[model samples]
Target: MFITLATLTDVPELTALINASYRGESSKKGWTTEAHLIDGQRIDNEGLAEQMEDPNAVILKSMDDAGKITGCVYLQMRGDKLYLGMLTVSPLLQANGLGRLLLQAAEDYARSIDYHTITMTVISTRTELLSWYERRGYQKTGDVIPLIITEKFGILKQPVEMFRLEKTV
Candidate 1:
């Protein structure tokens, strides 16, 4: 496995992998699916390109033996903290340690940049995912933020709140 910064040329595949890992029928193969909570494309090429262009942000991708991206996480610098989000592992590869490896890479990136904290927001309804993070040393900050809804973000069938989690690096 190899982990590297995602380039613009990888956006389309990254977008599809993200959607399949988080929402849609393909996501159902993994325990991380949000298909029951929202319905729509997880991200579009335009949005992904914007993220790739953000100077303070980066998307780290994990490649398989065949050189195919199989897992990834989005990281952004937020002052002293690195905001981690959109962590995706191919449904077929979930629970096989790739997620943890990506997370370790994220922490390494944080330390390299001198950031002392890492923060991420999880959907309140995703208890299992939150638990997994807790096991990894993240603690809930008890800060609930209203979900941000945009045209491409997907439809919220019910009100969704984001629970903030933080870890001091």
Candidate 2:
């Protein structure tokens, strides 16, 4: 597999990949499924397009030998830190090391830009995901915040919190 910087042109497929990876039964094919927690779309096309258009943000896409996008990581420079988001791996292709590759790319990008740390938020209840990050050198940081309340995020049937995780790069 190879990783490349994504452009606005990749938004449509990225959006579809993200939604399918997190919002429904299709997500169950992967270990990163959030289908049980969130009932709506993970992210919409417009929002993804905006992220791609942002001058300071870049989404790194992972593709297989045949050039299919299998995973992606959204990254942005915020002050002295790199903010990471939407780390999505194709549901059917999860656990094939795509996620780890994308994460290493994020760290390399952060180091290239001289960021002191990389920070991200994970659903507070995602123990496995959190542990995965922890094993990769991220620390809990003991910080938790309520997830943003926005219609586009989802309709909450239960309260949710996001835990902050940081890794010094």
| Candidate achieving the largest TM-score | 1
- Global lDDT scores for all candidate models: 0.92, 0.88
TM-score, every prediction: 0.98, 0.96
TM-score, structure 2 vs. true: 0.96
Per-residue CA lDDT of model 2 for 1-169, tens digit only, reads 8899987788888989999898888988888988787778888889888888888899999988988788899999888789999999998888878888899999998988888799999999999999999999999889999876577966666888999999998
The digit string of per-residue lDDT tens for model 1 on 1-169 reads: 9999999999989989999998889999998888898889788899989988999999999999998999999999987789999999999999999999999999898998899899999999899999999999999998999887785878877888989999998
Task: Give the root-mean-square deviation of each candidate in angstroms.
Answer: 0.8, 1.1
**Candidate 2 residue spans exceeding 4 A from truth:** none
List clashing residue pairs in candidate 1. none
Residue 85's lDDT in candidate 1:
94
Specify the poorest-scoring 10-residue window by lDDT in model 2. 148-157
